[model samples]
Target: MNPTEWRTYLVTQESRSAGRETAAVVEAALSGGVDAVQLREKGRPARERYELGRRLRDLTADAGVPLIVNDRIDLAAAVDADGVHLGQSDLPAEIARGRLGDEAIVGVSASTVPEARAAAEAGADYLGVGAVYRTGTKDVPDETNGVGPERVAAIADAVDLPVVGIGGIDAGNAGAVTAAGAAGVAVVSAVTAAADPRAAAAELREVVGDGR
Candidate 1:
């Protein structure tokens, strides 16, 4: 439940998995020793996402890793996920906490010190901050995209919650994010689209370890 301890966090996206199933990608990541997983299959039907979440929940639970659902508290509850991660445009963290209860691990995306500080005030357990490098994995605001490590350092210095640097991060640059003060790194294609996801995750984990 401690995000600061999640050195290697994987955000799932089947489209980026080189035609593999989302479950398959996650299975590889788990074996690669990912510290946590987030189910982030945006644009899919609710039933489809729920069924996938069910399978993911089982995998992560067995692996003893936390499984977080993206932007859907009900889906998280339906699949009995470990928590929910919300974007700025999604539900407020406080309302999400109210529905999920105080024990749930609620996180919100942020790219600046103000956003990070606001999430802290809203009782978020952690902050997903970045585009520390350019990203195409998800659409991001131009103003915040590629904010870089210095922005990460500012947010970490400004907020009290753990910060998970995401966006465009890979084994090559993950260290910069952590060196800048992120507690962990959250990545999609770094593991999902790799020819060998297990090895990709392991390499990124190794880099993050060195940085930490």
Candidate 2:
């Protein structure tokens, strides 16, 4: 997948991942038009995470959607995942690029223009920006305080890479982020916790596509 296609992203399978297994939710999301999937299993043992990544790798490969492993470059490399998403505190993008090589996608989380620019300069293929709204899916630093659409616009303006607005995003407000110049939105609970994961993903895809 190319940078432009990161739109309609899904960051997967949290504890709130209700009703179905993580793989099932991801399968349904891919079928529903999620362009990419990030396997973000924090707090699990490396072995457990690796096994899960392997399962997701097969599923995502079959669907032809990019699967990004969160944080663990080793796990990503082990599974030959399409990419890895790094946080501010994680490994530097340049180093990740070195380890993952040129073909693998490297995305970094950024909350400011400077951070976004640095990530881009460091060889990041895309940027995940926000806490666009207050969200409990992941613990965000209090300083971020939900940067909102304007910050997303600013970061989009500052960075040459694709910017995906994450945190508390759903079909209702996804358009605002897209209109603010984000190439896409990264969602967690909005899809994972939904009664119908496929339907939820489809709705979000519609909303984001309309925004673009």
Best by lDDT: 1
lDDT of 2: 0.90
Per-residue lDDT tens digits of candidate 1, residues 21-123? 9999999999998999999999999999999999999999999999999999999999999899999999999998999998899999998788888899999
For candidate 1, the 10 contiguous residues with the lowest summed lDDT are: 136-145
Q: What does the lDDT read for residue 160 in candidate 2? A: 85
Give the C-alpha miss distance for residue 168 in model 1, angstroms.
0.4
lDDT of 2 by residue, 117-156 (tens): 9999999999999989988787898878589999999999
Tell me the lDDT of model 1 at 86: 95
- Give me candidate 1's TM-score against the actual structure: 0.99
Best by TM-score: 1
Residue 199 CA error for candidate 2 (Å)? 0.6
**Clash list (residue pairs), candidate 1:** none
